[model samples]
Target chain A: MAKQERAIRTRRAILEAAGAVFDEHGYMSTTIAMVLERAEVTKGALYFHFASKEALARAVLDEQVPFGAVPPQPCKLQEIVDMTFVVGQRLLYNSLLRGSVRLAVDQETPSGIDHGAPFRQWAQALTRLLELARDRGELLPTVKPSETVELLVGSFTGIQLMSRALTDRADLADRLAVMWAHILPSIAVPGLLPGLDARADRGARVLASLEERAAS
Target chain B: MAKQERAIRTRRAILEAAGAVFDEHGYMSTTIAMVLERAEVTKGALYFHFASKEALARAVLDEQVPFGAVPPQPCKLQEIVDMTFVVGQRLLYNSLLRGSVRLAVDQETPSGIDHGAPFRQWAQALTRLLELARDRGELLPTVKPSETVELLVGSFTGIQLMSRALTDRADLADRLAVMWAHILPSIAVPGLLPGLDARADRGARVLASLEERAAS
Candidate 1:
């Protein structure tokens, strides 16, 4: 058990290191050497765990994304949006990881790699969450699950892309919050998503700062 | 005037070549030599036009984006969305330019670059258009210009990001039209964008093919 724990820790460290490097330089630019150096691990250990770079990249993406069963709890769709907003903002703000995200997002999938499964999984998650809201009678009957998912996911990426383009808007959290605050009501139950909590407000404020800078 | 026209032609050729090279090899990986080779222009000719690679990149971006003048015809906001969809689809379809776009989007702005002015200009353009729509009573008076601009810009990028992620969705033009069909009605005046045109329906068929492959 003790040995297993050490192995898990090492793997986590390596994953984190790879993620940081990938986020900074992008996958193509980031070399395995950097990950090893950052993790202070040997090439043998990395190869021992993951056989290839593609496998490692996939692992890093998997680990970074919360793709598995979302915590089953009493939360509104708005809360889910907020949760995603908070988590996504944290990931974006980390100076080391931000670049990697840009790289990952911008990097075209090599030929023959089907990204649909993962993409669908994300869409499904959002769809299911919306369904839950609808089931509770918290949403309008006219709101289609597919459309809502499309809007939420699409808009989120759109904002992120714009934010990425304009780097000074580091406080994307607040902007995201404001987006949800105003737009969520259009599709979801009013007040299902809590008001811009402190963290979300910070995101809004960050966006405001960027806006002010642009105006100036 | 004749000499100036020749210079402009050379500049246009260089911009086109730069975009092609960037699209194929990606921004970081593309070289001036590759661009010159593709453009079939001598180094002297290339230099006579663009001062440096960065300048070339700026020119390429500016040239690709129709930012110089707004369209002359009065079209509904929905029409704008549809036009943008077609433009985006055509741009991404060029495999050579696709790779470079990622790099351009992900490239870190050097200190003091102030890239936001361009983005602000885009937002202002959209805002002005939205105001026009409102004046013509094509949009709801309650619609907020800032939010609408954010949504418009964000959703467009979102579609691009999603299309890039799912490669089989080759009919990006069609999917965008369907998306517009679904979304425009929510915001635009009734009967403005009209139903999905034949072009958009064809796009839907293409998306179906990709979706089918993805599902299988």
Candidate 2:
């Protein structure tokens, strides 16, 4: 058990190190040596966890798939809004998520890695949520789940990218709030408009509640 | 006069070749030699036109700034929509714009190059247009031009990027139309909604008319 725990820790260290390097230098410029140097792990140990730089990037990409921070809400539309807001907050401080975004968008990444997988997964997850919202009569009759999912995903990506470029992602949550404000009125049922809270500070509130629940 | 014309032609050829190479290989990996080979120009001639690879990227970035295709509309909001649609059409075939976008977003770009200039210019231009819309009483009283410009620029970027990733940008105009459909209601005054055309075919129509005017 002790040996197994040590191995797990080493693997995590390597992943974190690789994510930092990939975040700073991007996929094409990141090297195995940099990860090893940053991780303070032996080459053998690093190789044991990830075979190549592509594997490291795949791991970072995978980390973005299971975004488990968004707690459930009574309002499905609000839940979707919460999910994006929490993600924007996470992106502000989370190295792995930041690196995953970089890898996903970087045009120089080699074709062998499936960079599109994360985006497709995000779309699927959001589509499923929208379907649930529709079933609950939360969405307007004119709203199509698939189309809304595409817009949400694409617009979220652009908001984050622009925020990163202009403010180093300091205002990602605010930008996402603006995005949802502009989009929700068109997609949500008119009745839901008065109840939805798409404020820039919503993520911080949700995150605080999540941490509180975890502590309890 | 003949020599000056030849110089201008050589400069244009070099810009085109560099744009193509940058679009394919991105900024960090692209080499001056590849651009020279593609342009079929001597090293001296290429240097005479562009001092460095960064200079070439800046030139491509500069090409994206002069977006003058949208004809005047009584409604300034519709004119803003038309500008994006025309740009979508241009992006469909314009290597310079495509390359400029890649360079502007790529994380590996060196610090010496001003990657954010194009985006800032775009935001400034859009802000000016939105101001016009506000002045003309086409925008809702609640809408702020600066914030709206940021959202428009960010969302348009996301829509274009998502189209590129998913469909190789084949459906960019369609996506832009969808974007406007969702956004216009939030920002434009209710009266203007009936007259605005946010159809996917608008780009094709705008492009056709531009070509016709140019030929005449």
Candidate 2 lDDT, A16-89, residue by residue in tens = 88878888999987989998999999999999998888889889888775653588999999999999988888
Residue-level lDDT tens digits of model 2 in B101-130: 888877777768887787789988889889
Query: Lowest summed lDDT over 10 consecutive residues: which window, candidate 2 chain B?
Result: B62-71
Index of the highest-TM-score prediction: 2
What clash pairs does model 2 have?
none
DockQ of each: 0.30, 0.75
Candidate 2 docking band: medium
Query: What residue runs in model 2 are displaced by over 4 Å at the alpha carbon?
Result: A1-8
Task: Give each model a TM-score.
Answer: 0.78, 0.94
Give the Cα lDDT of each candidate.
0.60, 0.86
